[model samples]
Target chain A: MISSIGILTSWLLFLLLALVFITNNLLKINIYVRLIVFLNVCLFLLLEIGLFFDDFTVSYISNYSASTTPPLYKFASLWGALDGSILLWNLTLSLFMYFYLKNFKINTSNVDIKIYSSILFFFVGYTIFSSSPFAGCIEANEIGCNLSTLLPFQDLVSSQIGRGPNPLLQNHPLMAIHPPFLYIGYVGMSAPFVASVSRLVLKETSSEWVNVAQKLTFIPWLFLTIGISLGAVWSYEVLGWGGYWAWDPVENVSFIPWLLSTAFLHSAKVTKHNNSLLNWNYVLVGLMFLSTLFGTFITRSGVLISVHAFSNGTIGTYLLIGMLIFSLLFLYIGSINRRYFISSEKLKNKFGRSGFFIANNILLFSSAIVVFIGTIYPLFYETIFSRQITIGRNYFDVLVGPILLLLIFLMIFSIKLSIKNINLKKLYEDNIIFINSSLLISIIFLMLFNRSFNLVVTISISFILISLITLNIIKNFNKKGNSSYWAGQIAHLGLGVLAIGIILNFTQSFSQEIEINSFDNFIFSENNYQIYDIVQENLPEKTELKLPISNGKITKFTSLNIFNNSSQQAISSPAIFRNLIKDSYISIKSINNNTFKLIVRENFGISIIWIGLFITSTSFLPKLKLRK
Target chain B: MKSKKFSLILIIILIFLSFYKISNESRFEKWSKILLCPVCQGEVIYDSPSEYASDMKDILQEQIKTGYTDEQIYNFWVTRYGERIVTDNIARNFEIILIPIAIISIFIIIFLRKINAKK
Candidate 1:
């Protein structure tokens, strides 16, 4: 009954949205009508929460919310499946729309809200009619059938044993955080997008729209970065793989938008400063919005078989049509307004600040293009040759590596040169000490570690760039530069730090896989590890292996559990002995009666990545405050 | 001015040295990395520990021993397992190469046109 009401409310919200769209005036839309739409979304949210706890009649709840399922996982089941996930997407969009309407309530012609609402309406309508969570239970021969729909005798067995959420999702707490943050990041892009469209439609070249786009872009971009990082952490922790990023299609899709948005952010600043890269900015904003939709389509449409893709369906066609229509609309609008985006100034020097922004945009956009090709090339290949293909991380790493190094070079070089004047003499004079010291330090550091000669050169370059930036920041602080300058300096420092972390961790980290019998003491890398005991636990049936690593002053226990379910999956909950310099990680990969396979890894200086990310995120808070 | 020249030379030397090192890497290692793992997502057969990946790597090693060039070995895999074996077939499919080139070309064209419009 609640499911039926939720579907009904969605239709009502759609009607209200259409009425507002027809008039194209947000102010004319009745307050009661807007209030009712908000209420309708709230009602659906409440119903979902209620069904999660109580209503087994709802097939989704019955399938996911088992008696033994943890309370935390029960709440997470709201987005465990396609239908529930769409509902959550619609809810987030509506909530944002409601807030947008209220925020711009005084304005007579807020077409941004109308456009946003229409988008929300289309999604909500899609959710209700096509992928409704409230649909009646279908009779199936599966083990976990909807017990409420079955006969009394059938309910006796099936009702007691529910299927629960996907085992992989239920395994980790990060699953609860990763998907919501990603969805918010995805949905949050709608505002800047609509604002960009509004600028073109209103035929205005005011810096107002650019300012709006910049501020709105940060909110989503911030969440997207965190979401991506959380996903990497989740993969490292839960997948039993010692690696973080694999350049999977799902990972690439999320990264594509981040890259485009980074380009947009940089170009948007140029648009404000010199009224340049206006059309570039527009294309990026449009692509960002399209890419979010594209990402959603990839994950939900199941056109590609991935660990992350939803079950196969007809949604891919729908999404493809939507993307085409949106692309055509953008092209149509952009051609008409081509004259408006043209700037009066050309870049005077290639080494100037504006040139830096331009270079950054090119690099970022190029990377995004490469990633997009690598991701979609498989599908493209299948279409042309009627054969399956997969493009792995090597394809991307080979392209992106040189581009990133070039970007780092551009960053330091541009920072050294002034915008108006190109003084190579003064630039060299200012950076001479830093340059010498960085090269000296990097060479010595690499020699100390006795790393490969190739790594020495790259690390030396990275060190030099980082040192140059750090010295500049110190000089700026000594001169008492403003917080905004500091923000940029700190953020750039974070990037350098992150790059160093990635390089060192990638080059220096060592892993070994060993098979052991019962309890044994093993010595590796000047450390002793004891597999003290292996105990089998009840309540889901997991065999837990306790591994204690002792290093003179400290001892840490890492548990590896083999979940004996239908899948027969064994996962090791790795214990990380983290220090400022390095992390020693150990986990059990698999267990066969008396024999166990263990993976031990030492990650060198990877803590800086997390620290760098923290610093970078905090730098944006000041900008948010200034905008507010 | 002397320092600037010296630094420029140093950067050039560093880049050259790195390139020299990169060029010296074995073709067998390079080919092992180019092929995608059939069972695992985003994993190259060179890095994956699966039985299939190990077998594929052994074949690549055997092919290299027989004096088959990287292109020929890649072709052998393609014929054996279709286009799915190699992650990047830049030599086989010209369309894949066009993707980045076309995108970069479009950007350059637009940027150049925009700059020239003002001039």
Candidate 2:
């Protein structure tokens, strides 16, 4: 009964809010917004109450939460399944809308709010109609109740116990936070999208919206960078693959928005200066928003088979239709306001700072396109030819790799060109010494180490980028520079560091699967290790097999957890020994009588990737502060 | 002029140095990475921990021992499981490469044309 009431109340409230905003163009009523936000909060609290109380009467609670689950995991279970995640997504969107309305400037009209509220209403209605967590199930079964349409229920069987959260999700704590970060990043893109759409709808020609959009873009971009990196870290630590990025369809979708938003940031920066990329900024913002929707659709609809996709539902079609509606809306707005997109000034120099910014935008956008195509091509091929094909990491490595390298090279010179009155030739003249020294150092290092082709190229470019950044810091350390300038340099440095880490880890990492007898020693990466003991523990929910392997000085315990669930799934937790230089990862594949197979991997310079990601994402902090 | 010549020389040296191979990766390691595990959702045989993947690896090893070349092995998998099993069949889908190149080139050309019109 409470679930039904919650669903009806939220549904009616969203409908009423959308109607109010649509009817009253000048509606600045804070009370209405406050009431909606408060009620949304209450709804979330109600769900949490149900989860904590283990209310099997509520289908979502019974399906995803159990009494034996930990408190943190109980909290995280709200987003573990399809219905609850949509609710979470709606909550995040509402919060973003509240902040956006609160921070709206005076000159900005209420149309933006109307469009934004309508978006919220659409999502809320979609949730209510399609995948409402509050919807009651018809009959209880061993697994759970079958999802029924939105209707009032007499009463569910309260005697039924709840199934716990997915074992894979509960195994790692990172699962608790990763989705929220990605959702925040995904939902925040709507702000810039709304601002741009409203700008076009109002036919406002001033560049003031650029400032708003740029500020809006950065927060989401920062969160997205962190979100994607945290995801990489989670996969590396938990997936037992000894690899971070797999270029999966779902991963590519998330990255596409990040890439597009990055392009928007640069182009919007240029638009603020000279308005050359005004139309381009609008298109980029639209694409960024569209890509997020596409990502959500891909993840939820199960159109493409990805490890991260949720169960198949009708919600995918709704989202696809939503995408269609928004695309048409964007196109109509763009066509009517096409004249307003023309720039007042022309780009004079191809090698100037603005020019490089444009080039950067192109590269980023092109890479986004490449990833989008690579992700969707398989589906298209399957539909057309009735055959499945896999467009995997190698496709992306071949296509997007050079673009990233070019972006890094552009970073090396763009900073130098930012100085006043410095042409390309003049910038080159100033940095020639640093460049030559960097090249020499890379060549000598390559000779000493004797690395692969990919490593040689990455090391050379990374050295050049490092030299450029160091020189720029030495030259500008005492001088005052804008927050964006320093942020750009730090982000560039982070990119360089991340690139080097990725390449080195890829080329230098070694993995081997060996079957060894009990207490037998094995040599891996020139280190001798032997299994000292094996311990097995049985818990209420799972059985764990722990193996303590020692390298004469220290012992590390790696365990395989076998869950006593319907799936009987087993998850291996790798024991990773980390230092400043490399990480030694060991995991047990399987064990038989008197013997066990171990997958041991050595990843070099992997720590630098995390350091680089930290630096890169935090580089936006000063700029965000400036926004305040 | 001096910087341009110096950069040209550097590029030449770097290109020559890239061909110097040092890392030793076995043929099995190379082929396992591009072959998708039949049971796992997007995981290559090189990374998947499923029993099916392990069995596939054994079969792959047997093929190698039977003197099958890289192309022959890939062809065998493709024939058995269709094109989906081979993750990186660039030879078959050449248009995937061309489409991106064409899109990027179009963007560059349009950009340059716009700049030239302004000039």
Candidate 3:
């Protein structure tokens, strides 16, 4: 108990000093002070185990006792609930904060770094004060609840039997790695914000920070790519949403940051080359930070009525307020720095890459804003007008589609230009034959397909992917030092694959709602389902039903499970989902007998998405060599 | 000197054109983002892909090309679906709180920056 208390205490202290770390104008403390603070935070987390396991006659342990919960869950419980998850976010933020500080070159004493570090500190501190997971369930003791009740089944299992992790979390191998990877992407926006803060606070009238920001920018974008991909994979095989992206607010939340960061990544390059888009870079990074804040708010705040946003509370309000304050501060600073921007660049052309960047940012922000308002509109309506409103896929698809086509066109052409001016006449003279031939081929392919417009969209987008692949392949030319390029290519290709999947799945998916008793599979689309084969006997903690899905050509089955254990099952029916790129969604929603419901959707292009993700995931391993 | 003048003139023309196109596209995207999808109740008009949504988007595109302010476009939708159609239930209160909050926070930050500048 004492040991765990120590761990909790260290994080509390770390969280408290966060503001001092981020805002140098308030307190420009020594770098060592922040470092010591985080060191203590890490120590506290380590100490928590003792308090957790001790058979103490204490407040938290008596209710959430070590005896009732699984040890794995007990450990995982650090982020399993509201208070604990907040603590987890703070801990992660603290870890990143310390690491970021430690990584700085000792001699590089730029004054803006104070505010940069302070931002990280403030974020961590607010997270601790507002939402700490290391909060001992001391309040449980205030009511004299059973210690067993304190430690839910999973936590008890964590104490005794090492119950498999949350069956939903355990369903696919991707589940294990997805969330941590996402947190990296979500929090990694700090790097660019740090750079942007330098631009704002120190008035570093140089492009060097943009260069630094660019070099580091791809990292979070890449992680976010993987996270979104893995999330889709998780959903396809689990949520039984049949499709990967449900346009769910949570899914859109992830995509919004990805879009902003992507715009930032691209715009930063323009700034890197021509010293143009300095102002745009500020906007992009600020937007990226806001997206992260908004995503946290959406996921945490119950204001949004999405199944995910249903987890709303005072913590949500605190987070939303935190996000609003953070956004306003950054926005204000960015506006103030308007004078320092490389304003009125003389080299921009009306219909070139700069235009592309501008259009892309607008579209990206538009996408994020639409999502932001839609996600929160329900709560606002309820509070202001005493009316409840629900917004769904109808709200998103209309606006996002045409912009996607526009983006695809931009992607195809934007990369071929740079600062010293493209000798367009000379390049056109050189590549006219190539460009004309490609355009002709695309036209012919579309004409032949009869759905020429859709073909145009797909072909142009695919060409962009192909062009990027060819360019990178040629540019790197078997180079070992080009891991960044390799990562970019893999990620770009992943986007292409995802896009193709989206188009094909939308155009070609077949689904049927089926009622099944212990042994029947309903046939739909290009596949046959033989039921009864997927049901597996109860595991130690839960019961599972597997659906074997097979196209006559390929035999693959997805399994679904209903967690029956009283300790394991609670709030919502969380299921284990595996995306074999074939079929199988293991859901805990079914209660058993004739009443079980499963919507089996057979999709054709899902595998393209899987393959795309696999390629991207493979790229991550090769990067161990690039660690320096 | 003649060549420099020509190049500078060309650059200005190109930059203006780029800015023009960007501004135009951004307007359409901005207005589209705020519009509610008729088919998908909670989603934005931009991210939806249904038939009704695509038709509405086409109309929105026409409005943008023809030059409609965001408020005008919003009003058009509001007239069609009532005021609930224009602002999301969440953003309705959002504008009221968001404006004051943005103002206050901006003021505070500016004040701080100024104070620091003095010290």
Candidate 4:
């Protein structure tokens, strides 16, 4: 069978499970259905994996397999192709099914519970039946060196050589873990969203539901944030791109959900603060789930274009159907409850955390809306206008950057305002005095050595630092078990530091386009880059010359590129250079003379972003630890 | 909650306005020649430097600059790349195939419901 048939079978199996789940009142089928569904998922995953990993004996496998492909890469290669990647997607979903089936048991005879089961069924049915990883190109292969093909897979096999994976994917170690973590985080949050929907439509509202549900949502959000950050770091360092977040539609798909989830996190707080907003909270949580499915739809459905999309034609369409159902069904359900949701009278507290919470949701929604427009606008253009208007960094930079800046500004300023009016004079007198002193000390220390200085940035940071310190002191002055309170303060402080890093790093970045061999004179950003010496060398993996580079005597680094490799004497790397957290770009065009070659400009700045990300990543540690 | 909602709306409007202003000032930097070639898929021809994925960056940048209201640019590329413009190709047919199916199915359910209610 082609990939399509296998995936369709998998969908049928999930649908079978859904039927069993719905009829649980009539038939004792919980354990049996779980086992059957698990087996079905496993079967689909295997067949899909086999489509990539098995030999030419299997038509698709032989066509894509290669001799030089390593074992680890061979397995990872399962996700290397369009259909193969869908296989991985199916597997991630299946594993999620396993986890949820084990922990969460549905109480039978409830139609809402049936709806929940069917929701999952919709996801599975769409994934397997339509977007089958085993869809097409079931071509047989002949074993030889890829027949001297120009676009053949790689250096390994001859005419029959199967390409291992995208070279960029194979080059990095993080490739193995990043996609799985990201997908898990993406799918894992579905349960919380589902449970919230269950609680809402079932009209079983309680603080216990909120407490239980928030934990489920929060943990996944934490992992998803970390996963997204790690992915950014990977792209920055590995892709050799000086910058991360190029505003790809695929990246926006991942980001949109995160934005909605951020709203979910905050709106949950509103539910606790005001009993009236409980329905809004449920709707928001459901929307978060719908956003995740929408992301999957964007990826699987082929609505968005990017490197991250994987569509097997009809599978994608099935998913779109599911997404449409999800959106419309939930909207209808929520609208039916709209009358119940209306406030008898609106609470107008101009000064409180509730006000901030509301502001946070709208901005988060605003951010999501902007990204959604940017992401899908191209698809609309292509489909309706028959145009290929590509939305890129410029669009996102223009649209999203300011919105994010606004969010950050709110996040920072939110600290200053409180729900209840308090004695600000006493608080400032106690903490601001010391904070301002520290700020003065640090500002002086920085200005003397560094040429660039900003008083507003320095002062704002002082405010953040002081608020954090004061907040902590206030929260745990008597060693209270309320570390979660301190966790919020520290996390906000980390974001403030991140803002500082962004500003400082952006201010200091320098670049100049010059060839290493010919550039005797170097001038960039009021600083001169000097190349002292160049020596050709050979390595086990690659061959190139080492050029010693310096900016005055303060900086020393090596610049090089491979023109040959160990196995194939002529395998040359596109001139690239790197460090763990930072990258210094080098583009070698051609060696004109023995000593003269053309090269592009040098650009580097991952450290600032990643370090900022690291700070943001660690901010979660306190929160996770505080969770009981 | 009401006050907060108002503040949030106000903040969102301001943010949108700021972006609208920025969009007005920004210029599109198209690299269709370097980022995308009519012949190839998933390859950006610009050279990489300083450990910077310049080729990919150029490609991505070009994709982004596809213009906010790029009715003209998008149409031109669709003619150029055909359906191959996007390699994933999953979501496109969904608009054609599934929307109709979903609509048809929904109506059938509604019709069946009405009959049952009459009975």
lDDT of 2 by residue, A461-513 (tens): 88889889967767884576677777788888899989878877877777899
What DockQ would candidate 1 receive versus the native complex?
0.30
Q: Which model scores highest in lDDT?
A: 2
True contacts kept of each: 0.31, 0.53, 0.00, 0.03
lDDT of 3 at A269: 62
lDDT of model number 4: 0.52
Each model's chain A TM-score: 0.90, 0.95, 0.78, 0.78
Ten-residue region with minimum lDDT total, candidate 1 chain A: A149-158
Show where candidate 2 strays beyond 4 Å.
Answer: A23-28, A105-108, A419-422, A447-450, A474-478, A624-628, B1-16, B111-119
Order of quality (lDDT)? 2, 1, 3, 4
In DockQ terms, which candidate is top? 2
Residue-wise lDDT of candidate 3 within A327-404, one digit each (tens)? 777877876776766352443553565555656665665556666665565567669887545554545554566566
Best by TM-score: 2
| RMSD after CA superposition, every candidate | 4.5, 2.6, 11.2, 10.5
DockQ of each: 0.30, 0.48, 0.03, 0.05
TM-scores of the candidates are 0.87, 0.95, 0.69, 0.70
lDDT of each candidate versus the true structure: 0.68, 0.80, 0.54, 0.52
User: Could you tell me how far off, in angstroms, the CA of residue B94 lies in candidate 1 after the best superposition?
Assistant: 7.5
Give the per-residue lDDT of model 1 (tens digit) for A1-628: 6555555666677777777777754446656346645755675575567455545545666565565667777778788877678777777776666665565332536666667766777676665656556543454324344423211113222233456677667777998889888887888888778777866777776656776777678778878888888887788666655567778878888999988887787778677777666777788899999999998888778777666777636567767777787778778878888777664455565556677778888899888988888888888778988988776655666677677767766656645545664676777687776786676566556543436544665577678777877777656555654444555666666776777776667667766666787667777667777665565555553456666655556766666654433353445577677776577777765567877666677777668777766666666654654443
Better of 2 and 4 by TM-score: 2
Interface RMSD of each: 4.6, 3.9, 13.5, 14.0
Model 1: CAPRI class:
acceptable
Candidate 3 - CAPRI tier? incorrect
